[model samples]
Target: MTSQGLHLIRGVSHAVFRGQHDDRAEECSFRFWRCGKGFEISVDGRDVNHTEFHLLWHQLVDDNSLQNLSRFDKWFRLWSEWKTLRDVLHCPTYTLKLAKTGTDMRVAAHLVAGPVDKPAYDMLPVHVSDMDNFAKGLPVCGSESVRPGSWLGHSPGPVRGPDGRLYTLVLCEHRALDAQRGEADMPSWDRIRAYVHLAHSGVDTHCIPRLSSLVTDGGLVAGVLIDHIDSGSSVQGLVEAAVSAEQLLSLEHKLALWRDRITLTVTTLHEHGITLTTPEYGSTIHELNIEVNQHDQVCMLLSFGTVSIVVGQAELEHKTSDMDELRTVFDERLPELIVETRRRLAAA
Candidate 1:
């Protein structure tokens, strides 16, 4: 659907985010399309302007056009697109109101349940099929799939950052998740989790990963930030924690910590021999990165041991992997982090 064509579903998104967003962001988006114009709703909610959204949207719609904005100024351009879309359509701002179900989640149940007759599954052409060859002509590093600095398990598909860099959105790990409730094409929790696990923690001979683990095992995915309560918390605990963060932190702080924690955590997880390249469990495991543009609220991502620094426009991911015994090293990483925090807090 063309950007201007999105006006048809502007009201549906308005209705969905307002009443049903609480039930499920994905579902609301899904069902909103049952009203029949999905591409329109997504284009509108993504709210990027016609020209800019067109640049990114075109990449998504054409499987052969996916460009890594990291190679260009994508992160920034995404921000511009969102702003333009919002102003042009005048969408009511997307806000988060707390719920009892999770630390962080985008799908809601009730709104999705009501009148949600099945909308035929029409997957957003999120990937640019074999776009790699075509992308080489562009200025950015042309890769088939972007080697994300950090894999944040948010939702499936893609996210165009404020910078204009196109990010494949792998939503936070799902705990007792159900995506069928909505109208649009939202991936199952398992699909998303599989993607994260395979994408970031790829084929490792020693680590026998299981897709079932993402669904039922004590395995948890923190959908948003890393706060004190969630530092040692289980993945199941993260859902509520994420909701609280929306209530607690400002937009800018949230975005910063999202990038910070994921960058730090994924670098640490790699030592276990996970390359995030396999398919069996591609997008299942990940620490998500959420960046809010708002100012005021402040928070710190739980960067236990690793410290990240930006060398220039590019952020260098650095860590110490010289440890001989991997198990012994990971075992102590979190324990020592807790002790250190206590000491620092006491000294303060």
Candidate 2:
């Protein structure tokens, strides 16, 4: 049991963690309940003649630390022991039930799912080309023809290009692009060209998605097609999952590496006179993607969206503030974000 899980159990007047026990003979439900100063554990199935249950019962009975312990201490001991048993037995799913003291209060049930499966996509080849030729000869596809995938909501989805290679299209709203052009006095296509040029010019092109071609609809630039990331999660999603599972401490080193990768990538972009636009501020996490392998190695990738070429002093100041906010998020504000996520989970 984690400290956060123990805290939750202590705060609630009554709580229970229930799940199915691993049994080949018969399906059974095992429950652990914490009520006031006492606890109750039960197992129900068609066939209850298993030795595993008896073994667990005997193990708990033989444990002297659980005897004469305070309410919180005893519950903690029991939870830790049960969790060990559960993991060894391969019981994956659990439901946590929490209730207040008042009879009028309803018991809140939260189903804690097992390990999450990474997002899946069809394995496809990526088409890479120079930005100038790619943009010039790019085909215009109707927005209605493209279907969104699980990759990044409705914006980017895997699409086969003219060369029959798979790529993801990031559609830009024409109105928004025009607004940016009016503000910056630079065409949207020019900004994208400069951004892609800088990304390709870097020694580490792995962190940036490869631009293949631009997609357009009715003369307006709809989006650009970039290489598809095989198995990736948004940076925001990764952080939220770590916070939810209370694994932040164990994975802190990995997270730090990811942050550094992102910082280095952005710094490289800034050095090339490319900075994120004003609208992209405070939401840099969503623009970043990461893939972790079985060996625990991480590959970071940047999804280009709403970037501008730094032309003057105003743009330089904008870039400075953006970098500052990026540092603040990964460095100073991460703890607060984790706490806030925990609070939301508890409230829910």
Candidate 3:
């Protein structure tokens, strides 16, 4: 239902906003699509202003507005209700504008919703000594053993610290800054700091990696220091190995235990207002550590970037439902994967 000439960003398609049957064309309130490098949008066929569109985008996605409804539906309801009343009174229709500056789009919507001012990401500066100390005398922010380096494929680097504990430094990526800055697909370093702040204020710390310190340079966030999670092994590896033996009963038991643990993990996350995306859970289960902490074994959810703070129970339920669906797919596939593994193993 998108109007012609609307250029969508890399990872998104017009079909997302347009309902299956084109029922959402006019009914939708806003049209802000995520682009690979920036956003391409058309708000009511009017020239979209930078500031208002930015505010409106955040208002739409952040406040649990994108939970159950499609983007179009959510924005439409809000705009329609407000517009109907405003139009009847013969008021001018305010537009959401997008200002593009060298790959950065700045939109202000303070007049309609969200914070009165944009957040300025200022924090402590990151020093060479800090990186060296955290990395146990290793190099900072690049590839080398025993050093702090960027993790492969869109992740921060994990480093060994002087305290004999592992740490990871999450910094701002160029794409996230100059491109998708402010979109929920990739959180700003400041927002990550906010999540850390929330965690420090008495959320369940055991379920997540321990955040150690904030790394910055020149008053801007350079990176975040998170405790590196150590694992005896991963749940996925264990499950897959068990499945390779073709022991149905064992596989079933493993699957059951995984179901329980995953449920518990999801519960703990919800209790603290956190939700994990699909890549952070199902596909990345191999990254989750099952390690012994003190006298007991614990599960550490890795990759904070894949998580988000939900608005309410509704959003939480929606997120939890997605996790559960992924679990179901894994459960159904295990039997077949087990058979495949067993055949290959036997042949070997």
Best candidate, TM-score: 2
Q: Model 1, range 41-93, lDDT digits (tens) per residue? A: 32222333323333543443442333332343322222222222112111222
Q: Which ten residues in a row have the lowest lDDT in candidate 3?
A: 81-90
Candidate 3 residues 15-77, lDDT tens each? Answer: 223211124222234332221111223333133334445456434333233333233332322
Question: Quick one: RMSD of model 1?
Answer: 21.4
TM-score, prediction 3:
0.44
The candidate 1 region of ten consecutive residues with least summed lDDT is 209-218
List the candidate numbers ranked by TM-score, top first.
2, 3, 1
Which of the two, 2 or 3, has more lDDT? Answer: 2
Candidate 1, residue 344: Cα displacement in angstroms equals 25
Candidate 2 on 252-306: residue-level lDDT in tens?
Answer: 5676876677677777777777665465322333324455544554444333334
Q: Is candidate 1 or candidate 3 better by TM-score?
A: 3
Quantify all predictions' global Cα lDDT against the true fold: 0.27, 0.45, 0.41
Off by over 4 Å in 3: 1-154, 162-165, 175-185, 188-198, 240-252, 278-305, 312-317, 346-348
Using TM-score as the yardstick, the better of models 1 and 2 is 2
TM-scores for all candidates: the values are 0.20, 0.46, 0.44
